[model samples]
Target chain A: MEPIMAIVVGLLYAAAIYMMLRRSIVKLVIGLMLLSNAANLLIFTSAGMSRGAPPLIPLGSALPDGPVADPLPQALILTAIVIAFGVLAFAVVLIHRAYNIIRTDNLDQMKDTDT
Target chain B: MSLEVALPVIIPLLTGTFCVMLWRHNVIQRVLSLVGSIALLASSIWLMVSVLREGHVVMYMGNWVAPYGITLVGDMLSAIMVVLTGMMAVAIAIFSLSSASKSHERFGYYPLMHLLLAGVAGSFLTGDIFNLFVWFEVMLIASFALLILGGERAQMEGAVKYVTLNLLSSAIFLSAIGLLYGITGTLNFADISVKLAAAEHTGMVDVIAVMFMISFGIKAAAFPLFFWLPASYHTGPVAVSALFAGLLTKVGVYALFRVFTLIFNQNPDFTHELLLWVAVGTMLTGVLGAAAQFEFRRILSFHIVSQIGYMILGLALFTPLAIIGGVFYIMHHIIVKTNLFLISGITHRLLGTYDLKRLGGMYKARPFLSILFLIPALSLAGIPPLSGFFAKFIIIKAGIEVEAWFVTFVALLVGLLTLYSMIKIWAEVFWKKLPEGIDPTPLKEGKTSGSLAVLYLPVVLLAACTLVIGLHGQPIYEWAEFSASQLLNPEGYIDAVLGGNRP
Candidate 1:
């Protein structure tokens, strides 16, 4: 199960890197979108596969007695996804605005600030 | 007891929120921002005093104990960083009052600035690695909006690069954090230190270590990774540039120093060696880049990268004195660089240009401004009796003592090059005759004198700070030395974060 998840993550990353190399700013953004999901999947795969119950304790118990899945990675992934969402949403708007102003979608055309 | 640890983060958060609430009242919003900045400064100083007098200040969230709960810890280094942030907050707040355009003031600049400050304060104080990532995002998003706020073509273009590179760094950083958590099963810095020290270090640990370094290196604007900085920094308003100049990359440097000294110490043979080469490359490349630029802010932006090299040099040397010099360099550089940016803002406001070729006659026309510029400019070049002199002196002295002759030589050579660039600005901007057809009229030339006064106010205050740090550098150096010791020896930090209660 872990190996399959790993392979899937690797494929996503390869696709992301490919999309990133394109000249179109729009595809560049798609690359970024793919990149972030690849990272999120990597986190999920690396945290190790476990068929454990939900992490909850009995009403009066101080701690759970059974094997439970690690909750931390889930929390970490949730935070990472939300942050990526906000940032990517921002990236989409920014590229759109840049397109509107510069009249081009090519990253090569966006080199005015380089000088 | 832990409230002291929380105040620096809270004041800025609350202030930013309230500033948003008073969205329609610009005047009231300005006042709130100013008060919040002062409160942050006061609280940061308070935290440092306590940390210096007592030991580390730790506060676990929601009554949870160490290693299991989120924690905020204030050691000497964090305390100093918070103080610097506080100082910059106040300086920027006062400067922004008059510097911001009406539209800029109306559309969320103050809130974003405070939010940025909050993120900086939180990053310095958080005991958890994941919390650091969260804080980085908070800072990044705010900076992203600020960079493109005006929607100018130059700004939007620059924002495309800045936003894309920073988001990539965040992605890399998040992935690194995930891998680290997978291995250590804990996010707390001190806990990981203890765990890794006890367990046999495998090759995977070194892999994770390099990953963290690369992500942080990008943020710190280290060599080969600093292209985004000069491209975008000059596009923003001067105050925003000054803020980034002072705090943003320093946060990255701070992370490097912290992780290397604590969690990554076990593999110094592999890691520190890499950092040494990185530092030298960063210094040489940055100064070379600056030497080529003629624009006022672009030159300064490149200098920011070069100065970071000195701080990293100190850290990489791995001596107590070197760490002291590194710590002192960080403190002194923040004030000096921010002040230089503020001074640039004034030069722009007065003479109506930032291109050095068109800038001139400030010596004859505005001797006072020339003097203000001299203090930071020369100090930045490591002149004696100014802050940069002492910073460079200590770092070089430590390098010599360690017998690292080549690095020591590079350090000295960079100093000379730095002086050359600073002198170039002085010669071009101040000494040369005002070029033909440049506007003699200041912006809003007929505007109230009081607004003009506000512009000079932060500049003067920061210049005076440079003077004080230079003339009376003993206590400050000692403070840096003490912090350096704490960094090298983290027993107290580990105990406080993982076991011992706060004072």
Candidate 2:
């Protein structure tokens, strides 16, 4: 399962890079989204994966009763996902505004600020 | 145990949230931000004093035990960084009051700036790598908003590249953190340091180090990864660009210094050597890039990259004195670079453009402003009795001590070229007759309705800071020495974070 997940993560990253290299700004946004998910999955799978009890304490005990899936990666990935979502939302709006004014989605055409 | 470590982060966070609520009232927002910045500056100074009195100050968020929960540690480096961030915050906040447009203020510029400051403080104060990522995102988002606040076409273009590259760096940074956690099963800086010391995967450790390097390299605007910087930085409003110029890349350099010194020092032969070459490349490319630019702010933007190289050079040398040089360089560069940008804005206000080809006669027109510009300009070029000279001298002297003649030579050469560019700006903008194309009479002073005098406040204050640090280099050098020692030996940091036997 871990190897398979790693392969999937690699594919996602490859696809992200490919899409990001496209000239269109929209593709770049898509690429960012894919890249972020790839990162989340990499974090998820790189830490060992297992089907185990939920991270819950039994009754009033101070700790979980038995083996449980590592909760840390999930928490970290969740945070990454939320942050990525916010950033992606902003990128979409920014690109939209840029496109509206520049009349193009081609990234090369948006070089007005560059020397 | 003291709450001082938390105050720098909390004050800005609370102020930012409150300002967001008061966004409807620009006057209230203005007052709240000013008060907030003053409070932040005071608290950061207090944090520095406390750190000076009692080594490392550690605060476990939510009373969580170290290694099990998040920690905020302020050693000399973090303490001074927070203070520097506080100073820039106050300057930028004041500058924004007079510079940001009504529409921009209406769109929560104050709130976003405060939020960015909070993120900067959090990044400096965090004792965990993951928390640093969180803070990076926090600040990156706020910066994105600030960059495009005016929604001008050029701004949108710059902001797109800025956000894309920054988000990419953040993703890379997060991925690295995950990989590190997987290796050590810990996220706390101290815990990871201890764990990595004994960890057997030497090859993987090197890989992770490079990953961290690339992640931070992008943010630091190091050579080969600094394209996004020049593309985006000069496109923002003066206040926004100045704040970005002052604090943002320094955060990346700070992270590089922190991680390499603390976690990755076990294999300095490989890592520091790579950093040495990187430093040389960054310095050369950045200055040459600046030398080619005609725009005022764009040239300053590229110079930021070059100056970063000197700091990294200090790090690459990996000696105690070298790191002190790096630390001092950070302090000096922040003030000088920000002041330079503010002066560029002043030039824009007076001359009506940033193009050097069309600007002139500032020496005769406004001797005061030219003097203000020259202070930072000369300091940047490593002129004696100025901040830049001290910073460059220390770093170059450290390189010579290490017998790294080549890099030392390159550093000196860059200093000469930097002087040339400074003179280029001086000759074009101030010394030569007012360009024929430019209006002979200064256009009604301030671009915005607000007083031009307000815009000069930060520039003047920062210039004075450069002078004070330049003349009184002993105390700052001593403080940086102490900071360098703290970084060199992370024992105090580790103990403060995970010693379990603390009060």
Candidate 3:
């Protein structure tokens, strides 16, 4: 299961990097989104996925009774997902503004600020 | 649990929230911000005093023990950074008073600035890796809004590149944090150091180290990863640019220094060697890049990269003296770089442009302003009896002592090149006569000299700081030494943070 997930993560990274290399700004945003998801999955798989009992410990015990799912990576992935969403939203709006003003989604055309 | 460790972050955060409410009343907002900045400075100074008097101060959030809950630790290094951040906040806040456009103020510039300061303070003081990521985002979002506040075409374009690269770095940083946590099962910095020591698979740690390096390197504007910096840094207003130039990238370097020294020390020979080469590359490329730029701010932007190289070089040296030099360089660079930007703002206000080819006669016209500029400019170039000289001297001396002759040569060469570029700015913008067609505009032409005088205040203060540090170098060096010693021995940090409870 971990090996399959690792392959999926690798393919996602490859696709994302390819899109990121494109000159179109829209593709860049899409690339960023994909890269973010790929990163989340990497964290998930690298942590060694466990589909087992809930992470909650019994009231009287200080530890879980049996094999338990790791909750830390899930919390981390959720946080990353939210932050990625906010950043992606902002990136889209920024690209939209750039397109409206500079009249292009092409990164090459956006050279006005460069010396 | 000392609450003073938390005040540097808390004060600015509360001020930002309140200032947001008074956005329409610009005067009120400014007054509140100025008072808030003063409070922040006071708190930071207080924290430093306590840290110096007592050893490392740790504050566990929610009263939870370290290694299980969030921790805010203030060793001397963190204290110094907080103080520096406070100083920048005060200077930039005062400068923004008269310099910022009314429209910019009305749209909550002060609040965002305060929020940015909060993020910086938080980053400096946090003892958790995950917490550091959160602070970086906090700084990022505020900086993004501040970058595009005016919504000009160039700004939008620059913000696009800036935001894209920064978001990518954040993603990478988050991924690294997640991976690190997955491997170690702890987010606390000290605990991770402990866990990584006992954990197997050193290979994964090395990979994550590189990932952390790339993330921070991009932020610190290292070679091969610094395109976003020069492309966007000069696009903002002078106040915004000065704040960014002063504090933003330094935060990245601070992160690198912290992460590398604390958590990644397990494999120094490999990691520090890689950083040594990166330092050399960053220094040469940055200075060479600066030599090509004719614009005042653009040249300064490149120089920021060059100076970052010097800081990282000290870190890569990986010795007590070298880390001290790095810490001292951070203190000096923050002051000098910011003062230089503030001077550029003054020049822009008076000369009506940033292009060196079009501008002239600042020395002849405003001798006082020229002297102000010369202080920081010469200091930046590492002229003797100035802050940069002491900073470069210590780092180069440390390098020579270690017999890392190649890095020392690169450091010296970069110093000379930095002097060359500073000379370029001075010659083009000041020494040469006003261009034939350029108007010899008086400093008091449009705005009241009162407001212009306000703009000069921070410049004078920062320049004075450089002069004082240069002349009175012993205490600062001692402080740097103490901080460096603290950094060299993570045992003290772990004991202070974990209270000797080894999990």
Tens-digit lDDT string for candidate 2 (B378-441): 9999999998898998999899898999999999999999999999999999998886766776
**lDDT by residue (tens digit), candidate 3, B1-503:** 69789999999999999998876888888988888999999999999999998879999899888887889999999999999999998999899988889888877899999999999999999999988998998899889989987889989988988998998898789778878987898899999999998888578899999999999999999887888989899988889999899999999999999999889998998889889888999999999999999999999999999899999998999998899999999999999998998989989888788999998888777788889988998998899999999999999999999999988998899889988998898898889988898777564365446888899899999999999999999999999999999989988898899986787
Model 3 spans with C-alpha error above 4 angstroms: A59-62, B444-448
Clashing pairs in 3: none
Ranking by DockQ: 2, 1, 3
Scoring each candidate complex against the real one, what DockQ results?
A: 0.78, 0.78, 0.72
| Candidates' chain B TM-scores in the order shown | 0.98, 0.98, 0.98
Q: Which ten residues in a row have the lowest lDDT in candidate 1 chain B?
A: B439-448
Model 3 lDDT on a 0 to 1 scale? 0.90
Candidate 2 chain B, run of 10 with poorest lDDT? B441-450
**Model 1 DockQ class:** medium
Deviation (Å) of B469 in candidate 3: 0.5
lDDT of 1 by residue, A1-115 (tens): 9889889988988998888889999898998998899889888878866875788898999999878888878888998999999999999999999999888898898888785
- Against the reference, the lDDT scores of all candidates come to 0.90, 0.91, 0.90
lDDT of 2 at B235: 87
